[model samples]
Target: MTTLQGSAVFSACAQHRHRLDRWWSDEPRALVCAANPSRTDALRPDPTMCRLAALVRHRPGLGGFVLVNVEDRIATDPADLRRWLETADPAAVEVARRDNLARIRALAATAPLRIVAWGTLVPPGPHRDRVIAALSADGRHDLFAFGLTEAGVPVHPLARGPSRVPLGAPLVLWRAADEPS
Candidate 1:
């Protein structure tokens, strides 16, 4: 799995706010909102929205739809996404992912559909962006990578055990268009 840093995500959102805004209004859009909830350092969805707002404000085409649990194939399915969001007493893994969905849904109701990505993080899961890409390949959504950072991008190694991926680095997340599978 690729280790995409939060900083990279943040930078992309900032640099491409205009493109993202435009894409939201005109083209389909999606984001791998979270690689790891603990890694993001965002407890509430407000910061997430703030980051998304930066792009949504500029790109009106960036509809408010995020891909949750981007690291897992089954978790990202449209049906699975709905189940995760609606489930009660979910497992710890589901809880983390659901939290992201909860925040995203809340953001959607409060703000227009601007930012789109998966909000959930499940342990021993695939990389966030990779899962998103898989879903994209499955015709679940679309993406655009017009504005990306040049340095300090984090990369997920997809290792096992309790080792944490290093942070405070730059990372790159590639976006995709939801073409027919």
Candidate 2:
């Protein structure tokens, strides 16, 4: 994954949008679901995306890791993000959640690599769990994550250095039905 260039495909709402999608070429698109959107968009990318881009350069197949989020709202500040998630208008939140999931599904249709890396930002469940369930749905289940964060979710891209090995391995969450409860 060393400097594989491709077109940038960004699907986002207007200025005050709920979510955004920043994707690159189509060598092997991997679906990456994070806690929420930072200040990154098509025009400008934040440090998290920067770190992810560098990390992917070392690994081959993880090219064009498309980023989604457990929460759709964009918030650079953790406190503000949490508040929005908890206090935002229900109708708006629902709309954003649905839009995000639809984009994830559309991307997952072609992407072989799907990862769940929301960290502890998603209240340990709900939004995170919802996204996982959605990814596991439609009978096409395949998910992965780099490493475990302190919150026990997948390790965030920002937390890793290029020295790390392959992107991530398959997760049991992908095989939800096969596992016994």
Candidate 3:
């Protein structure tokens, strides 16, 4: 078994520190949650980040928000991503889920809102189930919202063009039943 320190996952999380660190200083008004890293090794300010930032900028009333992932590890190969999401070891998934939750809670302590933008990419399992439960139980339902795609799944910023986003509108959280249990 590979330790997290020696795994590619750790490297990915470490690389993203710069962007994540900014959240501490800037103190975002919202907290955005996405699925996980795809081909990219680090969670830098990519197009999705840019779009989310734009939302905060153009809509100053919405305030600024930090973006994060439900899973912090990197999925270098698309095929491997599917394997991990669908059938990875339960222990590993639990660890990732726990880390993600901790980060979310810590960040949420300061942020006023939480945004769910994982889209259809987030695989269904106990991990996701627990996350939803935590968010729902956190007593911040008013802060939770989703950015819907054309297909009606929660969407990542880059998934759709900026103009398409209902920027001024309040986002409705996706139904729990819509996701696989």
Per-residue lDDT over 105-135 for candidate 3, one digit per residue giving the tens place of the 0 to 100 score: 7676665566777767776777776666444
Question: RMSD for each model, in Å, please?
Answer: 13.5, 4.3, 8.2
The residue ranges of model 1 lying beyond 4 angstroms of the native Cα positions read 1-32, 38-45, 67-130, 139-142, 151-181
lDDT of 2 by residue, 45-114 (tens): 6777776665554456644677777766667777887687679888987887887777667766776666
TM-scores of all candidate predictions against the true structure: 0.31, 0.73, 0.65
Descending-lDDT candidate ranking: 2, 3, 1
For model 1, give the 10-residue run with minimal summed lDDT.
13-22
Q: What are the Cα lDDT values of the candidates? A: 0.33, 0.60, 0.55
Q: Which wins on lDDT, candidate 1 or candidate 2? A: 2
Q: Which stretches of candidate 2 lie over 4 Å from their true place?
A: 1-26, 160-181
Number of clashing pairs per prediction, in order: 33, 2, 1
